[model samples]
Target: MTYFPAADRYREMIYRRAGRSGLKLPAISLGLWHNFGDSRPADRQRAIVRRAFDLGVTHFDLANNYGPPPGSAETNFGAILGTDLKHHRDELVISSKAGYTMWDGPYGDWGSRKYLVASLDQSLRRMGLDYVDVFYHHRPDPETPLEETMTALDAIVRSGKALYVGISNYRSEQAAQAADLLRELGTPLLIHQPSYSMLNRWIEHDRLLDTLEAAGAGCIAFSPLQQGLLTDRYLTGIPEDSRIRTSVFLDESALDNQTLARLHTLDDIAKRRGQSLAQMALAWALRDERMTSLIIGASSVEQLENNVAALGRLGFDQSELDEIDATVLDL
Candidate 1:
C-alpha cells in the first residue's frame, strides 16, 4: 500500500471536550504503551502512526518508561516525527509522562523535582519535540513531597516544555490534593489517566470519576480492554502470540477457570449486541461523558482499525446495559 490516509480523515472521528480545558481530543487516542519499540521495524511503526492520523486520531500518548528496553519507544517515535508527522505537528496532541523508574538509582525516577525535570528533558530529546502537548506525573509518589512534584510540573509548563499538565493512577483523594496544589501554581489539572475496563472498576467504587468531573478535570482510560482479558482472543485459549502468553503483566494464571467462565459470559453478551468483546469493552469504557477518550495500544494497524469501529456501535439500550452489569459486575 502507498499509505495515503482516508479520503475524509478529518471527518472520520469525533472530538470531545477534555474537561473544562479548551482542548478537544478524539474519541479514541493511540497509545505508545506497547509495540512502538526499537526492536520493531521503524517503518511499520511509522505506518501505524501515519494511518492513525489519516483516520482522524490526533492524540498520541507516551511515557518515559514505555519500551521493552526503556526509552526506546520515544526514540523510535522521535524518528517517526522527524520523518512522517513532522509537517503535521500542529494537528497532533502528543503527551508524555514521568514517575516511574527510567534510569539508575535515587534521582532516576518518581515525583521528585530532579526526576521530573530531567525526565521531561530526556523525553523531549527522545521525541525530538520542543514541547509536548500534555505532560503527566505518571503516578503518585508517597515518599516525595507533593509540592516538589507540582513545582517541577509548573516549571515544565512555564518554560514551555509542555502546554498542559495531568496525572495518572491517582485516587480521588490524592487527585484532589494534586489538583489544588497545581491550581495554586496557576496550572489547573487537565486530565487523569486511569486503567478502567468492563472488568476493572476500581475508579467507580472510589468515586474518582465524580471527583475528577467535580474538579472539572477530564479522564482518558488506559488498558480499557483489561489487557485483552475482555477480548475474544482468550475465549478459546491463550495464543502464544498473545500478550498474556508473553507478558509479565498478564500471566498464565490469570486465565483460571472462573476467569474464563466470566469472559465467555461477556462474550455471549457482546455477540448479542452484534459486536466483538473488545468492541463492547471499549464502548462500555467510553459510554461515560467523563471519559474523554479510550487510550488504546495496538500491535498492528488492523487492531487499531478494528478498535475504532466500535465508535459506530456505541449505543447501549437499557436492557443491554442491565445485562452487561449482571455479567461483568461481580466485585
Candidate 2:
C-alpha cells in the first residue's frame, strides 16, 4: 500500500516563526537520533518517518554520527526521502549536524573548517539532497577557533548546501560568541538545540535561554522527556525494552529510590491534570516563548504519537508549577 500524508495534518500543528527568520517550525519536531539507524528494520524506519509526516511533524533532525555504525541513519533517511518523499521536499525541514565523532583520524570530527565543510558535503551525498533546510555545528569545539567554525558555516550557506545554520549543546558564552560571528558574516544564527527538560533545568540557571532570546535566536529543546525519565515508564521499575535497558546513553542505575520517589510526586500532578508525565514534561519545556519546538525521538510510531499529543493542552497550573519546582530532582 502507498502512504499519502493526511491533508488536514497541517491544521493539527501550529508552526511558529523561528526567531526573526522567515521560516516557521512545527511545535513538535521528530529527531533521528535513535531507532532510525542501520540496526533497525528498514520498513519500521519508513513507517515512523511516514507516520511523523502524517501527524504534521515537518522537521526531522539528524546528525552525522547517529547510527550505531555511524552515518547509517542519514543513509536510511536518504533512502526514504528518495523513495516516498521526493515530491514533498519543499514541505519538509530536514536538518543535519556534524560535531561529535563520525569518521576517523583528524578530519572525521569537530568544528574545524575542514571537518565542518566536508561533513556537510558527505551528509548531502548520503541524504541524497542538493541542500538541507538547516545545518548545525552539533557542539562547541574548544580545540578549534570559534571564527574558523563560523567561517565554515558561512561558506556552507554561501555554497547553497544549506539554507540556514544552527548550533547545539553550546554554553551561554559560546552561543553568544557563535551568534556574534555568524551575524558578522550576515547569516545570523537562527536556532539553538539544547537538552532541556524539567529534570534537566541547567539551561534555566545557565542563562543560555536568555542569551539566545536577546540575540533574537530560537531554541528547540531536545531530550525534553529526559530520556524517558520524566515519564511514568519507570515509576515501578526499569522496563526491559526501555532506552535505559537497550542503549548506552541511558542507564538503569539512574532509577534510584530518590528519583523514583520524585517521579511519583510529579506523576501525581500529571494524573490530576488528566495527562501523562511525559506530556506534562514536554508541555513544561515549551512553556516559554523562546522555546519554539520540543525535539523528541521515538523507538516506535506509538511513542511518537503519544509524545506529540502533549501539544493537545497546556497541562500545568500554578499549583502544578509549584509542585514541579519542589519535586524536580536536584542534579
Please give me the total number of clashing residue pairs in predicted model 1: 0
TM-score of each: 0.97, 0.97
Show pairs that collide, candidate 2.
none
RMSD values for the candidates in order, in angstroms, are: 1.4, 1.3
> 193 in model 2: Cα distance from truth in Å?
0.7
lDDT of 1 by residue, 51-150 (tens): 8998899999999999877899999988888777787889899999999999998999889999998999999999999999999999999999999898
Residue 155 lDDT in candidate 2:
93
